[model samples]
Target: MNLVLTVLEITAPVFLLAAVGFTWVKLGFEYRVEFVTRLAMTLSVPCLIFVALMRTDIEPSALTTLTLAAITAYGVLTVLCFALVKLAKLDIRTFLAPLIMGNTGNLGLPVALFAFGDQGLGYAVVVFAIMGIYSFTFGIWIVSGGGSPTKAIKEPLVGATLLGALFLWQGWETPTFLTNAIELIGQMAIPMMLITLGVAVARLSPANLGRAVWLSVLRVGLCVAAATVVGLWFALPSVALAVLIVQVSTPVAVTSYLIAEKYGADSQDVAGLVVVSTLLSIVTIPLTLAFLV
Candidate 1:
């Protein structure tokens, strides 16, 4: 009973903020998704990642373990999702990337912060960074049939992750005033991302929701299983293990839809994934958290 309430308390603000964006769009308001996304990705999210890594109190060894665990989990997920897509006779280009990558940034970060505190947020950031690099590189290639690996290196998120990792390793701190300013900007990232997630979902036009429902269920199951195996294999600490499961099991990201739309890989199918998977998370996240917490 206590655990149920704790899970709700952690997840409520995330969905509520997203709901605000969803409602705002339904009421016929203009929200430019591309602009908001650019702002968050280029500025706010980078700031958030950098500061979180720099200030994190988690041991450096723990961070490295989590990083390797995340990489292995995603690697396993890629192979598994590929096999599933082939077996289902789905369009591999359209379904593969979305299935493999979860919404680690907009959804995962905030949930980690609320559920596990600052240290958890720190661990979540590492997984998110790993996903960002993979999504920009391999995810793009899968969606577009060909993508430039160089583009991943050019992403602000990648730069931030590398820089942040360096700072963490060196035990360096930015000047007080600078850190405060960066922290303020970083603080905007969570709410902005949550609201943007709602706005994006509101605007998406889903198709084949029946298929999407089952696929989403499979996605959550496979992701949780893979993350659990990898976490145990790495012997991750309790908090890190919980964060790994939650982050990897997050719903399909809105970016998957955007990529499909841009690359002409059946945008409606991807949109179905984004909508169905996110709706499904309202149940799955709390249930998983109930166990983890």
Candidate 2:
């Protein structure tokens, strides 16, 4: 019962609300869904990241570990997914993005907050930093299929991160006006994200369910295994290891679908992958955490 409530508290409410929103879209609230997701991706999310990074108190040692961990996890996953494409003779473009990009920011952040409180959130911040940049850079490149690696190397969020870190380093508190503005915008991030998730869910079809589920299980399972080994090898604090395990185990990111749609890849498959992995994650997350935590 306690575990059930805990899951509800951490994950289910947003998802339930998402279902409601999904129903609304099914009934023709399509514009609202687009508005919410765009608001999140363009405004609220960046504000949230700026505020979180600004307020987080990071340690140098932890930052180092986070960089190493992020690189190892993502790098290994990329190579493995590429190999899987070759070995399985699957559509490389269709599977690679969803397989390699887990929902590290949205789901990962909440799990960290639940598991380790402020310290866990702190660890999540560092992990978010590394993964966020990599996602924008390497992620865009891999999914874009532009045939030029340079296109993926630009770092838009790097400026935001550096500015936030500069303030953190200076120990400067955000002035009332700036903080208030950020708070206002950041407050919308979750609702917008959930609404987007709802709309994305609404768009999923049965066509790709089988392959998507199989790929999702393979991607998430391998991600957890690799993260666990790396965490153990690096001797991360148990709580930090627990956090990494959950983060890496998260479903194919919602953004994976968006990116696929953008790149004219297999958007249906990516969307299906997102739905399958997210549904399965409720069980996988706690199971992995129970053992690792």
Best by TM-score: 1
Q: Candidate 2 residues 1-293, lDDT tens each? A: 77656655655654565677678778976445566665665677667666766677665466567668867877787888888878888777777867877776666776676666666765665666567666666666777756344433344334555666666667777888989998698767656665566676777663468877777778877888788888888888777777777777778887777777888888877788888888788678766655654
TM-score of each model, paired residue for residue: 0.99, 0.85
Pairs that clash in candidate 1:
none
| Candidate 1 TM-score versus the reference | 0.99
lDDT of 1 by residue, 36-105 (tens): 9999999999999999999999889999999999999999999999999999999999999999989999
Q: Which ten residues in a row have the lowest lDDT in candidate 2?
A: 149-158
Counting clashing residue pairs in each candidate, in order, gives 0, 0
Off by over 4 Å in 1: none
